[model samples]
Target: MVVDDDPEIVNLVHIYLTNDGYNVIPVYNGNEALSVISHHRVDLVILDIMMPDIDGMEVCRKIRKDNVVPIIMLSAKTEDMDKIQGLMTGADDYMIKPFNPMELLARMKSLLRRFHLFTQQDGDNSSHKDDVVQINDLKINKDYHEVTYRDSLIDLTAKEFDILYLLANHPGKVYSAEDIFNLVWNEPNPSNNTVMAHISNLREKMERAAGYKMIKTVWGVGYKIDQ
Candidate 1:
């Protein structure tokens, strides 16, 4: 989905994406974006930050409450803090205005590849691995891409879930911020702050219902889940 108050921006994105053989859903406002999302399955989103209602940040927050759709926020705001705020609000990526359509296309493809599950091999009758990964009261079902803590649903974005699953699957194994950045993001990130921010958000969400710490910070080392 491509959302922008500017018809020109939306139409431009729609044109480029459609020509690339993508089905484009162009939305003019945030409310309509939410409405369409609730009624349909959106693979990814390109959202404008400065909307008249709800805005992209708020829309991202709302979406993160339940859905884990990949979102790339767009803005003319060229401040570093603006970009940080967008990421902290659950955006998978952000881009400044006057961005090249080709760059956007490349980013879109990257995000889609990260977010979507790989298809099973055809004609292979091999049985699937047990998809459930349960630790204490935290249950992660890989098959359904669902996580529950103490029987309550824990709504996590895709990256968050991946991080949690990675730790939970290897309890007592500590992974440094750089290690996580490379493993989870599939790229080397210069700023450890990015990893830290996601870790902070993870703790805030899961520890609320957990009543005790789940992700432990090793300070000067890394992070881990106790066995």
Candidate 2:
């Protein structure tokens, strides 16, 4: 997602990314970015700071509540505080105005690599054990990065699959959002709604497919799967 009010900026990025053999989604504004993300799969976001509706900071914050997608904030506000705020708001990286396209591409590549590694690390850690974990009618195949319910395929993002496998692998064990985030993201982001949001999304999918929720939320404690 390349979000900016300027068409030229978006076009430049789209061209560079496309030339690198990457799929580019050119979003003209923050709202469009959010809408597109909700509907499509977005690996990363290059967001501009200033816009008429829903600036980059607010977009970053909103996205943080639900997603761990890599975000790079582009801003003309060359202030230390601005950069700090962007990072605190869930942006993975920040860039000043008139940024070098090559540098941006390098940073994007770095973040993408890190994000993928972090999301898939749990499966690697349990390599010595069976990667496939089946709980009742739900089956998670970490080796293939796939999930199935009642033998039907259930599509999921990489993070969603990680969180699901983490819980289903240990039936009856409760894990707080902080624990899940740290274990899955490999980053200590406690007290944020990111984990909750992911759980909610995952739960909905399970219910819709299986006609019942497989994940149990323990109020005040965390989430678990009944044995």
Best by lDDT: 1
Q: Top model by TM-score, which number?
A: 1
Each model's lDDT comes to 0.83, 0.80
The pairs that clash in candidate 1 are none
Candidate 2, 4-29: lDDT as tens digits: 99999999999999999899999888
Q: State, as a TM-score between 0 and 1, how close model 1 is to the true structure.
A: 0.86
lDDT of 1 by residue, 73-186 (tens): 999998877887887898877899999999899988977876565222333344334556788898876656678987898877777777888899899999998988787777
Which ten residues in a row are the worst by lDDT in model 2? Answer: 117-126
Please report how far candidate 2 places residue 162 from its true position, in Å.
15
- The C-alpha local distance difference test score for the whole of candidate 1 amounts to 0.83
**Model 1 stretches with alpha carbons more than 4 Å out:** 118-129
In candidate 2, which residue ranges exceed 4 Å CA deviation? 121-227
> What TM-score fits each model?
0.86, 0.57
